[model samples]
Target: MARLPVNHPARPIYRVLSGLVGLYILVFGVWGTVLTWGEPPFARDGAWALGLRANLAFALVSVIFGIVLIVGASRRGNLGHYMNLTAGVVFLVTSILMMSVLQTSANFLNFSMSTVIVSMLFGLILIGTGAYDKVGPEEHAEEARKHRFHPVAEVHRRR
Candidate 1:
């Protein structure tokens, strides 16, 4: 099937979902760093197995991630969808794991219960926007009309 362009309005929503998620993460990372500054880079009150703290390193990464989304906002269709899909999956898993586990009293970006919920929502948005077909019926028919009779299946030649 012929896929619609990212901005085609036929299908694809990463522009908004990713932009929001990216902005949130970016802000969270910066806020976390500001709060945890002057403290250890890797503290006992950190998330993840490697004791990943919300210090300078994490904050930089977050900023960079945010910039990527904001800059790539105009990117439509396949590439954008795939990127968001992958990121969404990763974030979903990590967030679920973090929420499920009962660890030490540590706060990354001052995350509360609401934060976790928001993260979950973000992940879902990414997945929904990326995974599903964004093409509308009218657009699909138009595309069909344009490519009608064209061979989409590859033909193999015997040597």
Candidate 2:
């Protein structure tokens, strides 16, 4: 099998940025979990509740993706993996919508700013990861045919 070549011009930058964003997500997740620990009463009932729940769910998903990124970044192949991009897009859109609806008082400025910053960073990481994956090299497992192993390369190839 032919050896896979390095694909990106800034692959290392992508990996480092993506990993840093992933770490940020993990930290934000812990912070959010702590903040929302109690069954506090939500402000709105219908649309607001829906938005809140969706945002919460998306944040949780972001945390999961963060963990995946931390693991994926250490290995070969693209730093911004497919799962990371998918989750990041979902998170970015949902978060912006939720924040717009949830912010009522100036007291929430800090919270709002933090959310936007993190969401934007996540979006950038996602886009970068997607680009990297589109151009990055993948190693074949042909040499490992003697062993009973299914390679990640084959799985991604189908996509």
Candidate 3:
């Protein structure tokens, strides 16, 4: 099995980056909600928030997602790792799905091309953050580092 680095030296930086992303999303959602208030849930007219087209429904979902990401980024354990991973995948998948229906009535979120691009970007960032945020004791970290540098030897030792 592939092993992620534990107690990575850059974990703090990644966490802070993830938190910044969450903050952006949170602010975007709140701003979108305010700008799109009293509009139809999926109105595709001409409502833009933070450079992305949004509707009431999309803004509401963004609020929830933003909050989840913020909470996850604040956690100091594997919870953040797992949450980031999950959120990354969700963002990627949602972006693709929304992109496919960009010009169709089925685009309930009223997503624009810019939104898709931003979502994909955020997804990649979150995944990268998650990949390096795993925490472990020094022994495990040392073992993981060894395995990373000497895969064959580590594999043989495991067996």
**Colliding pairs, model 2:** none
Worst 10 residues of 3 by lDDT: 148-157
Q: What would the TM-scores of all predictions be?
A: 0.58, 0.52, 0.92
Counted clashes in each candidate structure = 5, 0, 0
Backbone clash total, candidate 3: 0
Writing each residue's lDDT as its tens digit, candidate 1 over 1-159 gives 544332345353557767777877777666766766676664434432112345555566667876665554446535666767777786688677657642545443323344456557777877766655343356665765556434542232222
Candidate 2 ranges with C-alpha deviation above 4 Å? 1-6, 34-62, 104-113, 133-159
Identify the superior model by lDDT, candidate 1 or candidate 2: 1
Best by TM-score: 3
Model 1 TM-score (2 dp) = 0.58
Best by lDDT: 3
lDDT of 2 at 59: 45
Q: Candidate 1 — which residues are off by over 4 angstroms?
A: 1-14, 44-58, 104-112, 132-159
Candidate 2 residue 78 Cα shift, in angstroms, is 4.9
RMSD of 2: 11.1
Candidate 3: C-alpha lDDT: 0.90
Span of ten consecutive residues with least summed lDDT in model 1: 44-53
